[model samples]
Target: MTIEIGWKLDNSYVNNLPELFFTKVNPTPVSSPKMVILNYPLIRYLGLNVQTLQSNEGVAIFAGNKIPEGAMPLAQAYAGHQFGHFTMLGDGRAVLIGEQITPLGERYDIQLKGSGRTPYSRGGDGRAALGPMLREYIISEAMHNFGIPTTRSLAVVTTGESIARETRLPGAILARVASSHLRVGTFQYAAKWGTVEDIRILSDYTIKRHFSYIEDDENPYLSLLKEVIKRQAALIAKWQLIGFIHGVMNTDNMTISGETIDYGPCAFMDTYDPATVFSSIDIHGRYAYGNQPNIAAWNLARFAETLLPLLDENQERGVKLAQDAISDFGKLYHRNWLTGMRAKLGIFNEESEDGSLVEDLLNIMQKYRADYTNTFVALTFEKLEDSSLFSTDEFLKWHRRWKDRLSRQQESNNSSQQLMKNSNPSIIPRNHRVEEALEAAVKQGDYSVLERLLDALSNPYDYSIKQADYSTPPEPSDRPYRTFCGT
Candidate 1:
């Protein structure tokens, strides 16, 4: 495949046998196409020619003003359960332009989120505000550096036009790359609106593409469910350890690939509160910090529901099998959570008291309103060397017990400190910092702050002195934190 053609002949999604999976659509031509940022690392990673990508033609293609040669643009059709209510939803503002197969032979979905109207626009203008696109770009890249599975930004382009949400804001498009655009809700859509044969076809295609090891299994659909459950268990556990709040855990946002997707209104916790909710829409705390593991299990159960017909020939047996899969979610999540928590606390060996040790530390953290990222990062430093950190009567009490537990293990202090350092990140995309970046871009049309914050976050583990201020939590003046979906 030549770089001028942009992609190889294999558009598996298009060549595949289903017209119901997507609807053919063309991206509406924009007024002026301008490049804002191109992810050089990801471009090279995907093995695309950088010289071609930065050319004027590349700018037009990315901005959705011109379709690339041999590209098949379409809007994907999928249903989602929004906020516990099942509603038919599709790509209201986004379009999947094509799937790019890397020189390494791995395929990823190349999507234009905030690219204009599709068949699924549903009475809303198909456009994106600059802030949310920028938010997704920052957080998703940060998540990747944090060693988390995530959909990443390949490029961001300006439409040189204005979009109105609450008011007139600059329009932008995020060229997002993902393992695939398939989601649990994709299966939900198939099961609800498509034939049983369609569901089976989706299951087989999913297995062949992502889980070929399970292709020969006696019950591939059931096996797929089990594997998804396992990945989600591990992923959610990582989120808990790192204090990430996805904000919206709706069905469509949950990917079947188990990678974190749809970074709308998501925030990392500053204070260690189980009930922390930053999304302005999460009024009842349904997707709160402490509830992620359980919510993941719930989402998987819905996924299993979509696979019922393919799970087994007999309905009762299928229900039982799915129930067992759902139960495994709890077991798997607990084990992964415990294993991750142990690493954060520098516990190499499992112990009966380990759970309580972890629990007590959290209790003390909540009591002290401790900054989540800083508290764990502090453990790696000299004991109490940073006296300004989470220091209190309750924290000291927990610290004595924690030290006693560590003493039982034969690992050297240096190794334990190394484990702490590796497991805990010194910085995350703090909410206040993110807000500052967005404010600069949306209001003053300044992107330098966004670039600077992205720089600090790109090396989250190193904690370089120049980026020290990025690690701090929000002050009281920034209280009552709120994030919008930017729809």
Candidate 2:
């Protein structure tokens, strides 16, 4: 009989690394813990024995109160370039409890963010504040519902005690699910400090776990690099189409699995501005919306540098191969970005002058300072008669161009309109609404607003019957929201 209560980690990946990189360590103890949100769908999707994972015993295991049988808990090691400067960071306040082979025959890493301190904790308390923890839970779940590839949140547990951040705040931990925690920086950590053998081992293991199909290729290293670039470009284009600003798109924060991993200071834009940035630390707007494509290419270059030693026997030949592989990221990113923008504008066929059609709509939106989400949503609904709905009169001129473009495409039919409505989301996690919901939950323990927000967000593409308030942009009084690092 298959056991339901205990879990075993078939840790084949650990064999590739030195023991010192992941010394089995216990989490720092915390005060009272209370369960907040549990992701039932994910628990089932992972094909975890539901009886044990959802039981009180399972809740205890998830909250870090109990480590199940055969669980090899260890923190992952990695170095990252934070903002513009390189720094070594690891699972400072997070821990990989174990790895599970899901029922679908896929493998996933089970990790706990804010679990407690580890060897990588850089002289500060390794606990997460309530705000950031909840922010991740909200945004990650919202992204999943929006059909974007992202790490899923399993459960949220609040520590009774408080941690000091901008203020004394309550602490919480999030059980996060991912295809794998191996990142570009994971290889960087080894290349910069560990031996060449370590980089070779990591490359082999990464291929086995993520790109096993490329193993037989004579040039496996170059093929792996190209695959990572392709996936990241597609992922970033999805982010741009949805108006997500990752706030911190550091090298270490990126996952090789192409999932949107970290959600720190991340926000969806309100106004349709290309230069929008909300992360408090982003003083120079280096990771702004318009600059994400360039930043992604830059990060891929760094990853390319780390993999150079393993790419060829001769150092110079390897460097040349890596540069050539990284050069393809731009072409792939533009192709994916344009394809997505075409869908958003209801264009089905590729035309030589499609760029002008797309660019003109964006220019109009910028000139009008329109609400990004609502503008696209309004066009999907195609209620051009209602002019007052737009924040500016510039939408009127754009409406004509949008209609002219739609007329050229086959999707102008009634059936096409219906399909676009399903493709385009009417509601998203508006920044102001998210802040309002989270504040209410934290301050008063009133989850009604959070519940309502989730209800609206669940059917993002569908029109809500009585939820007009949730769809509208926040008033002038709720203009700015300051996001903090969950230190």
Candidate 3:
């Protein structure tokens, strides 16, 4: 198929920022770069020419060796609350090359992360180590396969030079695509500058880009805040249903578009544990698995605070309106979450106690310490009959409750079976598998393992043809593996 693309950079968003933030650009350089992986299918999805993107010259263009003709690289300036404390942070090691408005009128950023440093590079090397790059490529693609909204990896290029962290590791660059790179922290930065005019401008611009339905609203800023809160709550709740731990739920990492960004310290649960945290820097366990929803609501509160000036004319009125909007996050999250859980359990009708139904199942999972993926897989594998398919008594009890609820479900047995099949994935990027793939590539220079894992993750819903071993967690010997931030 012929892939077509058209791009227009919307410099209008950050047009009025300080010149130093935009004009002073210095990207660190790397040597003898090699193109390790290219997302050809995604390139076609974006309607770009694969022949050009795959060429040697295209490799240079992708690796930040040379910028594309119409592309403009600029680092965004934003502030974020890291571990509950606000800090000034921006794209320190990343640069937004430009934006592309697709044929469908969807705007996406063609960003070069690990390209080099900008003014935001806060006293650290602006390069990325190979391991993290590969991990993101694997996990991000896995997320997409699982039908999650995320930043897509366009390409991964190895910079021949070595980067020093705990060990000397090869450098790499990732070409990431996103709907928009604007974050809740972006609004926080402008709000902290204490410029109401800038806040209005930012709020108006965001409304146009994301929540255009509010363009004609009387209180557009308040409407935008409400819409963002709804989106974030739904996003976080989805993460919970899938057993995903974002690992770092800092305000800066939370994007306003509601797409999950920064796969630095992220993992799927092997066992049903609410407090699972894998990031080494997250010593306080603030962004644990169970805390993601609460963190999301907290970040939305910060976003609401930023828009207080434009939310209403009266300061008191604005505070009240923003609070009202932020408060709806819980209701919206619970509503969306229960909807998703119903699909998982194949319960189409709404129950007044749906949240309790969902919680009861989770309590059982916790009590049994059941494998999250396996439980769902078994349910989808067979109907509620013969609960013995699952190995645990705790699951059997939950299965009984599930069967009772299933008797009242509106969906036919066949329909429910099909819905369950679609809702629950058979495989996710297992943490140990990802680490093993990366280690093999880095230590033995074997890319086959990485390739195989990517192939499995590319279609997580299809377990029919998959090897039986990929669906299970790693053995006990492979337990306790932790991922590090490759700065």
TM-score: which candidate is best? 1
RMSD of each: 1.6, 2.2, 2.7
lDDT of each: 0.87, 0.80, 0.80
Per the 3 Å backbone cut-off, how many clashing residue pairs does candidate 1 have?
0
lDDT of 2 by residue, 42-129 (tens): 8778766766666666666766777766667888889999997898888898888778877657888888888888899898787887
Ordered by TM-score, highest first, the candidates read: 1, 2, 3
Which candidate gets the maximum lDDT versus the true structure?
A: 1
| Model 3 clashing residue pairs (backbone) | 28-116
Better of 1 and 3 by lDDT: 1
lDDT of 1 by residue, 1-487 (tens): 2456356525677677388888988788889878878888898888777788888888888888877766788888889888899987888888888888888889888899999988888888999988899999999999999999999999888899999888898999999999888898889999888999999998888888889999999888999999999989989988998999999999999988889999998999998999999899999999999888888988999999999999989999999999998999888888988998898888899899899889988887787777888888888784565534446777777788888988989999888888888888888999989999989988997989999999888878786885788987788764598888988
Tens digits of per-residue lDDT for model 3, 1-487: 1122333455544464444234335355667778888898887777677787777766776778876556667888889998899998888889887776655667788888888877788987788988898888998888888777788899999988887888798889999999888898888988886478777777777788888888999878778887788778878877888889888888888888889899998888988889888888888889888888888888888888898878778999999998888889988998887898888878888778777878887877777666788778778766444333365666667678778888886678888877887888888888888888999988888889999989877777777666456877777664465667677
RMSD of 1: 1.6
Quote the lDDT for 124 in model 3. 71
Candidate 2: clashing pairs of residues: none
Which ranges of candidate 2 are over 4 A from the true structure? 5-8, 49-55, 385-397, 477-479
TM-score of each: 0.97, 0.94, 0.94
lDDT of 3 at 399: 72
In candidate 1, stretches whose alpha carbon ends up further than 4 angstroms from where it belongs are: 1-6, 383-390
